[model samples]
Target: MNEFTLTADFGMTASDNGFIQYGIHPGDTIMFKKAEDFPVNGSIVAVIIDDGPITLKRISFYGDSLDCYLEGGSSRVAPIFISHAEYGRLKVLGVAVSVIHSLAPAEE
Candidate 1:
């Protein structure tokens, strides 16, 4: 099985960044496998669009937009909006089956 880690922050590191990536925080880890097929609604998927960084989110297909909910995210975290017109750029890399929160103390 192949695995992917956040070897590079890509300058997007933040508290909510981790929440959107998995659950806990940055430095935390998760295990996933290829999505194989387009994920259905409510499925946690690792996806990317328009050559952007990969992300983990629960997918929901809307009429002209793709609503993606971040797993274990706070109410303040906004859902990522992707227009159907950009669907061609959507790439589902894998399904996150498990998460491992970083045990290190979080900094304020």
Candidate 2:
């Protein structure tokens, strides 16, 4: 599996709701299977936009578009829909398997 360190929150935002207790904080390292190495359904994935920085997201495929969710999986933020026409702009690198949590607390 390939790994990458997070430099931003991505979709791992904090929540006051008690049901959502965990999140991938910045500085956490994520291990993921390469896109071609694994099948991606409704799984947490690493995504790159226009060759930009890699970030974490939960992705699902619809008929002609893709649905991308944030940390809490639609509970916190609305999904970003990527239509078939925009497929070239973004790419899914892989499916995230695990996260190495950072020991230090996050800076506010």
Q: Pick the candidate with the highest TM-score.
A: 1
TM-score of each: 0.57, 0.55
| lDDT string, candidate 2, 1-108, tens digits | 998665433233222232223355555566676676434566777777678876566666775434433343435665676665677777777766666676876465
Q: Which candidate is the best by lDDT?
A: 1
Candidate 1 overall lDDT versus native: 0.60
| Clash statistics: count for each candidate | 0, 0
Candidate 2, superposed: residue stretches over 4 Å from native: 1-22, 37-39, 63-77
35-90 per-residue lDDT for model 1 (tens digits): 66767777767678668887656776665445443343445646766665556777
Residues forming the 10-long window of minimal summed lDDT in candidate 1: 6-15
Error of 1 at 61 (Å): 2.7
